[model samples]
Target: MPNLLIIEDEAAIRRVLSKILKEEDESYQVDEAADGVEGVKKIKANDYDLVLCDIKMPKMDGVEVLQEIQKLKPEIPVIMISGHGDIETAVDTMKKGAFDYIAKPPDLNRLLNTVRIALDRKELITENKRLKRKVSKNYQMIGESEAMTKVKDMIEKVAPTEARVLITGENGTGKELVAHWLHQKSERAKKPIIEVNCAAIPSELIESELFGHVKGAFTSANKDRAGKFEAANGGTIFLDEIGDMSLSAQAKVLRALQENKIQRVGSDKDIKVDVRVLAATNKNLKQEIADKNFREDLYHRLAVILIEVPALNDRREDIPLLITHFAEKIAKEQGTQVCTFTNKAIKLLQNYNWTGNIRELRNVVERLLILGGKEIDDKTVTQFSGK
Candidate 1:
């Protein structure tokens, strides 16, 4: 059943429209608003599927009401009613975001059909969002290496509880991938996963970015905004490249972990968050701690369950399997036939030092697929790999 609002100033027309809509479908719960001002007020106060608004009214015009509706409740579809003389104004309303136009003394069939189409479109939008969330929920850990297998086992054992996970690995070793798998497999997966790339955000803004700020708190802070911790209230937050976080930010992070609360920048009131933190780093944190680059207390707090990802070279035995997997995936992505790699070519690739790790391997595979002939062999590897 769809909830509908009728914002026609004419009492007789409102009654007639309401009777027609209800007669067409008894399940539709319709309400009447006397004018555009009242219509905008109702929209802000409640959620509705469709709104039927008149083109002219006292205090606020239909176009102004439509703009306000879009600003506050953009998802609700609005069908504007215009008299024959108001056709130009109704077209102008469409440019301002009105869904569709209905002539004054609406044609019963046309009005009902338009309402049905708008309702169906809204349903489809909601369904598509739901399917997208389901797809994101299915972000499984993908790898066949023994290292990855062990990591998956660890995630299974640790996900049921609220222990902090510290994922350590070299650059391009899929540390972020492990973090995602941990959150998706954990009990908190149903909750939101707010991500914070400590290195990507500027150090000066990191504090406000994580803890939020009150209106007029800073030079550019125009309004009160919720921080990362507040946004991830009931779920997990993956802090990528945490080792690069500023010393001051690290102090705040340690306090949040210790107290389960965070105080916004330039504010004293602490906000509690039920967020499970998953931190990842490519640097040796122990060394960073020694150099005064990282906090030792935060280190112990985050490293409760350290899951180190082995570099590609450390797991040479998995190279053939990873190569074949990447080859098939790349072929499908490129819409080309999968090329066959000789045993010797695979062996040569396995022996090479993959300084950039698995990411580099995938790039090489793509290069070979694009540049090498139908069969990728040792000669192609020797030429492309600069061996």
Candidate 2:
């Protein structure tokens, strides 16, 4: 049931209004306040989906109540009710942030219609907020190391602004996690976080992948397609392993970064884009630049805020915590009870070389869960971990 608050100074008017709303729909749980002062108190105490307040009241007026509610609970929709002379005041109340207005001597149909519309609008606003939170949850970072802490701190500071970010780390070290953090903390979290692995795509197709192509632009371009940049409009685009991108593709990427414009591989028309580019690479771009394989200008452009993720070997202290996290996660995925690793097993894990880093550790933990006994021990480590 949707909670409704009616703020009318006159007790008789409040009762009549409540009766009409309930008759129209019993699903509405109605509460009444005699004056704006009492209405404000009720609003402060409980959360209501909709409020119906009269324009003129004693001790406080509807407009004052609306302003206070706007400060305290802006998401709750308010519909102002006006008397014969207060219709003009109700119009002004909307300027102060009222959802809609209904005239006094309440017209049943008008009240019902306005209430339905206001409730529907509120539902949409709430649903949009819920979806956005789900998007943020998709990018949850799962580490407690100092390296991750510093990366998170930087993301908090940089995500609000449109800054180019370059994430550097070894393979499986979670450079992509840094990129996700940047986008999730950003003002553009509501937008898509489009990811393109430059190394995965063939050099011949990288241009079309980043800038998109029109119909018949190339041999395989049967239809007009939007690329990563267009898909990430008003949000962020993450280019992974960018150092391995071809020189030809690098020039086009640099053009997109510098000019905020890109042309399709076989088309001459340029399209404007408003995208925040975040690039990551396992290779050393500075060395690649020295060899002339990577564009020096593009490297400088992308590295405005550089974040380097440390390898698991360097942060061995976090391995025990990480192991437990992955164990619980794997247990849930496999529909089994959470398993525990012995202290000796964790110590052995810390001593091993994590050349493949955190990604490798997660895989190793999953293997232990499946192959090892209820309690993962040092002997189980040697038997299954391939250490």
Candidate 3:
């Protein structure tokens, strides 16, 4: 049941509001307060979906009550009830954070409609907060090692800025995970983060992939399409495996970074884009630049805030935690009971080389969970981990 509070000095008006709300929906549990002081006490004692407060109350005014609510429980939506003389005060209350204002002798239709809308808005806000929590958990960085702590510190410091980020790490070292964290934590968290793997797309088609092509730009261009850069406008674009991008595509990426503009493949018209570019590469970009395989200028542009993800082998202390995390995750995915790793098994597994990093660790954990007993032991680790 949705809880509602009516704070009004007028006993007659308070009764009317409560009656109307209960009549509209019997499920609504309405509470009444004779003055702002009583209202603030009730607000602090119980959670309310919506608050209907009178703007002109004696002892303590509605505006003052709203201010207190804003300090105490800002999430609760407050609707100010105003008389003909208090309309201006009601408007000012809204500026101070009241959800909406209801005029004197509240219109039946308007009052009910506003109440429903306020409740709906509150529901949407609650749902959004829940979803954000789920997303944060999904992208959580799971290590307490010194190397991992440094990465987390860097993310906190750099995520709020508009500077470009270049994540460097070997294959399967969770470079993409770092990119996701940066985008998720940044000011652009609400905006989309389009990811494009440079090595996955063919060299000939890489340009068209990054910067859209006209309808008749090429033989395969049957329709006009927007590219990754345009798609990521007002957001972020993660260029994974950037070292493998063709020189032609590299030049366009450089131009885009330089001018915040891009020309679609085979199109002379320049299209402007407002995007944060985040690139990742496993290969040594400096060496690539030395060999003339990568553009030094582009490297400079993308490396404004470089984050190097440490290899899993270097952070061996995190192996035990990683094993538990992966075991629980895989069990949930497979709808099976979570398997456990003994201390001996974990120590033995940590002693082995983690050439593939976290990705490799997760795979090995999954294999052991499937092939070993519920309590994975040292013998089971030796059999399934292939260490």
Candidate 4:
């Protein structure tokens, strides 16, 4: 529900504003205050989505009320209610962070439009905050083991540069996490980071997917569309599993890296893209090159800075920390209490062969939280962990 506050000293004006607002939208939970003092009190007590304050009120005025709101709850947008001669004050209020002002006897269209736009902006701001929190959690680097520390140090050093990075690791070793950390810490952090899993996408359509295609370029190319390179312009593009990319697509990628330009499938015209490419692969590119399945020149272009993520087995000392992290993460996602494990249980889990790496550890931890006792024990790990 949209909770609104109407703070006017005059009883007649308050009633009019309330009537106009409630009739406009019944879902509006409108609250009333007799003066600016009462309005500030109400605002301090409850969370209001929007506040409508009169400029010339007894006790405190709207300007002072707005200043107080700016200090108290700046997120709650305030709209000044101006008298006929208070246009200058109304304009001035906007410069100080007021959302907008409505003249006395508010116009139905203007008042409603301003409120709607303000609410929409508030929703966007709220959503962006939530996304930022989520992103931080998702990209968090969680381990202090020597091997993990080295990787963290590399990210801190390499993320500031515009170098092409090749992240080599086995499946489930969290290669994409390194890619995300790089983008988050780089100068182009404000821009988008577009990711494409080369192995997941078929070889036949890889070219079209990377460089786009015009209408009638292929049976499914019904409309002109931009590709990943174009979308990642002035930002970063993460090519996951690049060793699986087709030989022909590798040629175009080589050209893009060499000339900073690419031609869409079935289009001879070259489109320039200022994109920093980050690639990852589980397979050995050298072996692939000898097999005549990968391009050596493209490998050289992408391997300017190579980051080899260690397997979970190599960093077994970090298992306890990872388990605790996963338990809390799972609790937050599932809206439950964080589950704890006994030291014996932790030892048992850490001894297991972690061929599937950190990704597999998280899954096992989630399973334990779901099925194990409140305080998980060694026996619980034995019974529930399918290891």
Per-residue accuracy of model 4 over 309-368 as CA lDDT, tens digit each: 999999999999999999998999999999899999999999999989999999999999
Q: Where does model 3 exceed 4 Å of error?
A: 1-138
Better TM-score candidate (2, 4): 4
Query: In model 4, which runs have C-alpha deviations exceeding 4 angstroms?
Result: 1-134
262 Cα displacement, candidate 4 (Å): 1.3
* Local error of candidate 2 at residue 30 (angstroms): 49
RMSD of each: 13.1, 11.4, 11.3, 9.8
- Ten contiguous residues with the weakest lDDT in model 4: 123-132
lDDT of each: 0.86, 0.87, 0.89, 0.89
Preferred candidate (lDDT higher): 1 or 2: 2
Over 1-387, each residue of candidate 3 has an lDDT whose tens digit, in order, gives: 889999999999999999998998788999999999999999999999999999888889998999999999999999999999999898898888999999878788788878876875676466546655665677668899999999999999998899999999989888888888988988989866778999999999999989988767999885456787876777789999999999988999999999999998878999999999999999999999999999999999999999999999889999899998999989999999998888999999889998888988899999999899899999998888876
Across 65-91, the per-residue lDDT of candidate 1 in tens digits comes to 888988998888899999899999999
| Deviation from native of the Cα of residue 339 in model 4, angstroms | 0.6
Best-to-worst lDDT order = 4, 3, 2, 1
Which residue ranges in model 2 land beyond 4 Å of their true spot? 1-138
TM-score of 4: 0.67
lDDT, candidate 2, 1-387, per-residue tens:
899999998889889989998887788999999999999999999989999999889999889999999999999999998989998888888888899899878888788878876875576466556655655554456667787788778888988889999999999998887887788888887777778999999998888888887667878775456677876767788999999899998998899889998886678888898899999999999999999999999999999999988888888888988898889878987999998999999999999999999889999999999999899999999999988
Residue pairs of candidate 3 with colliding backbone atoms: none
Worst 10 residues of 1 by lDDT: 123-132
Q: Of the pair 1 and 4, which is ahead by TM-score? A: 4
